[model samples]
Target: MNAPVFRRVLALLGDLRLAILLLLVIAIASIAGTVIEQGQSLSFYQTNYPEDPALFGFLSWRVLLALGLDHVYRTPWYLTLLVLFGASLIACTFSRQVPALTTAQRWQYYQEPRQFTKLALSTTIPQGSLKELATALSAKGYRVWQTDNQLYARKGMVGRIGPIVVHASMILILLGGILGALTGFMAQELIPSGETFHLQHIIQAGPLARIPQHWSVKVNRFWIDYTDAGDIDQFYSDLSVLDAEGQEVKRGTIHVNQPLKYGGVTLYQADWSIAAIRFRLNNSPVLQLPMAQLDTEGKGRLWGTWLPTKPDLSEGISLIARDLQGTVLIYSPKGEFLTSLRTGMSTEINGVTLTLVELVGSTGLQIKADPGIPLFYAGFALLMAGVIMSYVSHSQVWGLQEKDLLYVGGRTNRAQLAFEQELVAIARELASQSQTAEVQA
Candidate 1:
């Protein structure tokens, strides 16, 4: 690109108004991403947002798919916005913040006494000396510099660099966000107790995401805790991470809100279900039946299995369980309630002895891996430091000694009232010291 064109483009990108507009648009898109379900199937959108009477008259499944609302964060346009915003931050940092900081760091000494008159807070002390003024400023936490008859003092130079640091931190955050979107993956697995499995059911994955294949996770046990009112208090799963050689590398008991993290992946305990029921019938070999979750119409989750009471499959009984508390309800073939049994309990039904062995529970885990989390942590730390630094007032004071008269003036980028008061106090101290020196003379 030509120099003039490049400069124009840089100016455009560095414009504060443009940056603010982009930030607002990005915020709105983020809100939309949160309101609309992401990473869901097409059927889910169609069922939830029907076309006959579209949501808000325009948010149907077709619109969502066309606009990539179903996966907004992973969309090409969304990534483009992020890239553009990052570029804007870079331009603004280089074009504005850096130059401003450089200017603030350079010293500008006031050689002429008249120069002090242009300052925001200036005063003429008839008998005060520049040495006394410098001493007072130094005592007030200013870094004083003396050049013969001219003097300059400043404090809080870090405040000048604060905007630059803030910009750099924001850039890091953007880079981290982009990296996560390009390389993160999320998967869900429903593993029965005592079973080992790998991440296979991938729900969402970025283009560059690497799915691990050399490791597996085993659920050693799954159980639930109940409150005194019989409500579910919490559920837990004892999990073990195994390497390619089938050797356990890590083990932990994970519950809701407490997840297990290994390598780069994290395993969250999300849900649970009854996998199967083991029992014995009429002294026969032990058999297990898979349980199916029935539609409870919002009453609660219920798992059921059918056990044949007769050898010819002519009669059967339904076994229903509401929780992992070991209580199982048995119903007759006619849908009538028969009796309840617990684990290790036995009851005779239709002349055949039914023994309840165990109820195998499965743990639902949501596994995710993101490579940009460290960058995010570092970026946020810098952002906080930068904000605190920015709050510090960058104050500068100038002094000039012409003959026996001293000129003192100062200015600050922020905390104007406090800076003025500090300058007045320094002037008063200089006058007092001058008087004391005359008395000693």
Candidate 2:
């Protein structure tokens, strides 16, 4: 590219108007994402957002899917916006903040007394000497630098670098977000106790995501705790991570908020359900019956299983349960009430002894893996530190002495009221000390 074109590109990138416009677009897109759900199935949107009464008179599920609004952060256009925003921040930092900081660091002396009069806070002292003014400035915690009849001092120089640090931290955070959106995955599974499974059934995955195939998990146990009101207090699942050779590498009991983490993946105990029941008849070996959930048409949730009483499988009874409270209602094939039994109990029905065995429960787990969480956290820390540093108030003072007159002036970037008060106090002190010395003489 030509030099002028390069400079024009730099100027455009560093323009505050361009940065504000990008920020506005990002904000609008984020609001749209929050309002419209992301990472949902096509069927879900078709059912929720029908075409008959399209939202806003033309925005239907087909439109949403076509625009890739289902996964905004993963879409190419959204990612392009992030990249452009990051570039603007970089250009602004280099072209404006760095140069401003360099200028703030270099000292400029007021060779003529008229220059001191241009300051926001300036005064002429007829009695105080340059040395006395420097001493007073030093006593007030300024880093004094002197040359012949001119003196310069400043404090809180770190404040000049705070905006740069803030910009850097913001860039790091954006990088972390982009990385996570490009290489992370989410999955959910429901595994019965004593069953081993791998990380399959992915709900959402990024294009660059690499799913772990060598790792497996086992559900050792699952149980629930009851509250004093006979309601569910909490549910727990004992989980183990297994290697390729089926050896346990990690084990832990996970609950709702307490999750198990292993090899950069997190497993959360999300839900639970009764899978099957183990029981046996007289002179018969142990048998496991699979349980099926009945459709109550949104009235209530119930699980049922049919137990065979006769060898011909003609005569059977239905076992119905509502919750993990260990109570089950037994009914005949004709929906006639037979008996109610608890776990580890026996009841004779249709001339056969049926024993109620343990109810097998399965644990529902949600798994996630993201590689950029640490970088995001570190960027947040740096941002907070920079924000605090930005409030420190860079202050500077200059002094000049000629004949019997001394010129003094100072200024600060922030805390203007407090700086003015301090400057007034120092001038008063200088005048009072000069009067004391004259009296002693």
Candidate 3:
């Protein structure tokens, strides 16, 4: 890139107006995302707003394509805004706060009565000397002192830097957001138990289709815990990282709130489903064929419609038994049971045997990939630094001696009243102590 073009780019990045505009845009877009059901299919919008295809199509497809609302967080424009904001923060650091910090570091105290009368904070002390006041200020633990015809008192002035540091931290946070967006990709999959698969493809759209690849993740098990009231308390899944050879390399547990990290990617236990149901054949110990499993025709065992031949299971009637309490209903067909039996347990009926098998759990895992996290954090730090500097400021008091009298005054960009209160307290304490000493003498 040419030098002029690069400088122009930098200027645009630091432009406050552009940054503010980008922020507003992101805000508006985020609000819209919240208002509209993001990532929903066209049919859902159509069903919800049947009378208005215009609105439905606009929200369902047009807006999604235009702004990447279908994947709002990872949209290029949104990422652009974040980058612009971060650049603005960096620019602000260079253009504004650095100089102020420089100026504050070299601060000197210069005071006079004429300046005092002109000061917003002023006190006329005819009975006390500048040295006495300086002594009083120093006793109050102020580190700033003034000489050369000027008295200076500064206390807790460094406290002003805290907010700037906080702002810099915020910039770091924004930078994190950006980094997490650009170099990051997430792949979602619902893997059924007793099945092994790899995360092979991630959906990334752009000038060309983007396919994201990561180290394979294999789900081992998933479980859910419930509260006493039967509500779910927490959900978790057991997973292992796999090498290219399909060998398990690492293992960990992940939950809804807790995520497992490996190879710079995170896998979250997002959700679960009933993947398959197993049934014992005629009370046999070993013949446990999962009934809810998909058959060649895409029908599960629950559908009770299966061919007599299968690769995994031996050919048979492919029977699935349902529990009927107080009545033994033999159901060979889809909906009807052949006979009705009683509902109580331990009750035996003739001619047929039924046994329950293990229920297979399917786990839903959310996968994420990011490469620019550090840069984003850096921007976040700068942003926080700028904000804190803008909000918090250092101020001090300066005292002066001119022949017969003394002068004391202070000024600060922020919290001037608190500074004044401290100054008054110091002055009053000194006056009271002098009176007490005189009385003792």
Candidate 4:
């Protein structure tokens, strides 16, 4: 590109209005991502946002798919916006904020006494020496620099650096977001107790995501805690991380809100379900049957299994469990309620002894791996520090001793009232010292 065109492009990208617009668009896209279910099948959107009436008169499954709203964060356009915003911050920092800070750091000595008259706070004091003025300004926390007749003092140079730091921190945050979008992966698993598994059911994954193949996770046990009112209080899973040799490397008990982290992978206990039931029937070998959750039509979770009481399968009883608390409700072949049995309990039905062994529970875990977490933490910390530093006032004071008259003036970028008060106090101290010197003479 030509020099003029390149400069124009940079200016357009660094415009404050453009930055605000990009931020607003990103915020709206985030809200849509949160409101719409992400990483779902096409049938989900078809059923939820049907074509008949359409949502808000214009939004339907077709629009959602066309706009890539189903997965907003991973979409090409959203990622492009992030890249553009980061570029804007970089351009603005180098072209604007950095230069402003450089200018603030450079000292400007007032050559003419009339320069004091143009300042916001200026005063003329007779019989005041440059040495006395420097001493007074230094006493008020100003870094004083004096020559034969000129003096310049400043404080709070950090205020000038704060904007540059803020811009850099924002760029870091944008980079972290883009890195996460390109390299993160999320998966879910439903593993039965005592079973080991790998991350296979990938719900979402970035194109560059590196899925770990050298490790596997095993669920040693899964259980639930109940409150005094029989409500579910909490659920827990004893998990172990295994290496390639099937040796345990790490173990921990994970529950809701508390997760296990290993090798950049995190496992959270999301849900639980009934896996299988073991029992004995009529002196036969121990038989284990898989239990399936029934569709309760929003009533609650119910799992059931059928056990044959006769050798010909002509008669059987249905075993149903509502929770892992081990209360199994048995029903007759005619759908009549028979009796309830707990774990290790036995009851006779159809002249055959039915023994209830144990109910195997499965743990549902959500696994996630993101490579940008460290960058995110560092960016947030810098952002806070920059904000605090920005609040400090960068004040500058100038003084010139011309013969019998001393010209004093000051200015500040912020906290104007406080800066004015401080300058007045310094002037009063100089005047008092001059009077004390006259009396001693």
Q: Is candidate 1 or candidate 2 better by lDDT?
A: 1
User: Model 4's lDDT to the true fold?
Assistant: 0.92
C-alpha lDDT values of all predictions: 0.91, 0.88, 0.61, 0.92
User: Model 4: C-alpha RMSD to truth?
Assistant: 1.3
TM-score of each: 0.98, 0.95, 0.73, 0.97
lDDT of 4 by residue, 1-441 (tens): 999999998899889999999999999999999999999999999999999899999899999999999989889999999999899888888879988988988988999988888999999888888898888777778898889999999999999899888888888888888888899999999999999999999988888999998999999999999998889999999999999999999999999999999999999999999999989886777789999999999999999999888879999999999999989999998899999999988899999998888999999999999888888998999999999999999999999988888899999999999998988988888888778888998
Off by over 4 Å in 4: none
Q: lDDT at 97 for candidate 1?
A: 88
* Candidate 1 weakest ten by summed lDDT: 124-133
Off by more than 4 A, model 2:
none
Task: Itemize residue pairs with steric clashes in candidate 1.
Answer: none
Candidate 3 positional error at 438, Å: 7.8
Stretches off by above 4 angstroms in model 3 are 1-19, 37-51, 56-60, 156-167, 201-215, 224-235, 244-248, 280-330, 338-355, 370-393, 430-441
How would you encode candidate 3's per-residue C-alpha lDDT over 1-441 as one tens digit per residue? 998987787677667788688778878977876876655666865565454465645554554556667667667777777767767777766555565566666765664467676666766443446667777767767665556567766665454555446546656777666666656666778887656666654644233223434457777777777777755688778888877777787889999878988777778888766554444434446343333433546542222323232345443233332211112233433444444333222212233354444445678887776655665666566655556555554667777767644566677777778777877776676556656756886
lDDT of 1 by residue, 319-429 (tens): 999888888999988899999999999999899998988999999999999888888999999999999999999999998888878889989999999999999988888
**C-alpha displacement of 277 in model 3, angstroms?**
3.6
With a 3 Å backbone cut-off (N, CA, C), the pairs that clash in candidate 2 are none
